[model samples]
Target: MRAAGIPQGTLAAGQERSAGIEAPRGMEEDSGRVKISDIRVKHIDRELDPPFDAAWDPVPRTSFEATLVFVETDTGLTGVGSGDTMAGFAAHAHHFIGEDPLRMVRHVETIESINFHAGRFWPLEVALWDIVGQACGQSVATLFGGTAERLPVYASCGDLKSPDARAESAIALRAEGFRAMKIRIDPRRADEGVAAVRAVRDAVGSDLDIMVDLNQAWRPAGDITRSIDVPAARLIAERLLELDVLWLEEPLKGDDRQGLVDLRRSTGMRVAGGEMAQTFADSLALLQADAYDVYQSDVVLAAGMHRSRQLAELARMRNRSFTPHTWSNGIGLLANLHVAAGVGAGPYLEYPYDPPGWTPERRDFMLAEPLRIDGDGCLPVPQAPGLGIVLDPELR
Candidate 1:
């Protein structure tokens, strides 16, 4: 079915790029007339040097895996995306075999349905955006209605470091031009988490804004779970507030809507979460419950740019802060960056930077060039067409 409001010929048919390139299986001479000819998924695994400590995970993470997706049009203009493994999309590929890439309204409906029966099809939606941008000859950020080419950034760390070590890291992050940094809280030991935040505050000396993440989103399988009761979360928030943490993230279970709201109200601290929410409807529920002061939803994991844009607007309408949680990988980060830039009014963006394990070099291994922050501690939204990422064959 066609998406309503996208008039025929709106995506005019013709060559989007330099002419004379050989077309693939399903091409028409009109560039706007494109079809999904093929789709492929790849898996990349890399071993960490010192086994990173995933704060929320039950076990130490010694390695990391990336799931890359490629969606090709009949004209041979391909778009790339990365996110959670598309476990069973191969079997359901028939649903989008010859579909229009720009009909995002229809595509979003298709994705929501596909996710219910088989795999999480959100990443495919990202690929669709990539294709649409290329076809329209504009950057994804521009497509999302953003004018700024750069967005403010904050360093985000995943490993659990000792107080002294974290202090050193915070100092270094400041030197790297970051105005802010986020500390991962050890779910197993709340005291250690509190101490780590205190150390960073002492080291930074009130120069850097610190956000603490409790990572109460998801846990690994077979791990003994620690329930963070309302009182427990309250006590921790009190301690972090004393240390002057700017925000507390995911202190309680993500679905505990009332509890999250209560934590924000009682502590008077900015509470952030919603990166794990599955749909815009789910986010609406969180908003209706006043669950957080800040809403962070990843486009790749949540519903894709179309839904994320709506969420961004909703957050603005509610007078709450909105930023994307971008820890997945470089591609995932780029997707959110465009959305955040498109939404505008964002004060900062998450820049995953846990050295020796989750560095930008490792996170962006597949990209032709790794994304880096400028002297102003901001990443310029890529101006290139599509997702603006070129795949590195060596890394693949």
Candidate 2:
């Protein structure tokens, strides 16, 4: 297989059609042919007892849980994916019940028809891609035209506590082999955000790359009460630049295209956003306007593997950087990792590493083996067919 980022044509010419391995028991016909005879989508709710922190907003404290959507083909092969929702992903499943899991783009568009949808259905789409890749006996990355076997990863910590706590966390993550790290900021006080960065910088020294997430995109009704205005975000970006921050993420609302463009012009630090956006059109608009130095798209949130791949390709055609957001559980991380591995030049994959809440074990609670960062702070792009993740039967 050709390395990721190589032209798709190059990979296609040498791509392995199928491993020639037998399909799972139920998926093969009496003639021994493999075909998708059925599609079943189900939601698995795994709870996070304590809600993750978003200090700027006083939203109700709730459990952290994932609505896992499993696609089971008639052949007995299964592909797994996870979605994000406060009440769980029940509403999103209504649109995916009997659709072809392999026709991912069409599946996503069908689900997008639901009003109030946030593109969470993309996880289901990702699972389908996983299934299709497995059926074809190729890795998901290869399916996306990638041949690379590994990708860089960075630590992403949520919860805004004292600067010292943030600094200590950064140090620990560095010791654990993360070359880069990100910290969430208090949207109400730009100065406090700067101080947090300064403390981490001081603790980790200048060599470690740092990024700050403003999370201004999805301000719930409660956060609206304490949201920072555009001027305040601009000032914060300026200070972040002074601190030598590698990038400033989502300082403006997701839809404030003009504000993002202005912020990029006002600050030297690279500006990043788009995790909350749901379509290729939104990502294209952001890129066309030069809204950010890096594009942050989440596979699960951007409506699945097909659409996220399309966005990454758009970013590449425009000579922009793309790094997927990874705040959800391990399945979400895996889904994005597959996409990033295919993209070739994406920035570090976001690895959620906050302890007491979002540790690798907790984040991957449902999986048999948690994804671990290598000593060099990179994860081997999964070579297994489909998503390359094997869920524990017990966990299921």
Query: What's the TM-score of every candidate structure?
Result: 0.89, 0.83
Query: What TM-score, to 2 decimals, does candidate 2 have?
Result: 0.83
lDDT of candidate 2 over 73-166, digit per residue (tens):
6578787777554244555554555444565555666656652454345666777788888888988888777846788787887678688888
- Writing each residue's lDDT as its tens digit, candidate 1 over 95-183 gives 88787777777788888888877766777888888999899889988988865789988999988888889999999989989989999
Please provide the root mean square deviation of candidate 2 (C-alpha atoms, Å): 8.8
Among all candidates shown, the one with the greatest lDDT? 1
How much is 61 displaced in model 1, in angstroms? 2.6
In model 2, which runs have C-alpha deviations exceeding 4 angstroms? Answer: 1-62, 85-100, 114-119, 221-223
Give Cα distance to truth, residue 72, candidate 1, Å. 0.8
Q: What would you estimate as the lDDT of candidate 1?
A: 0.83
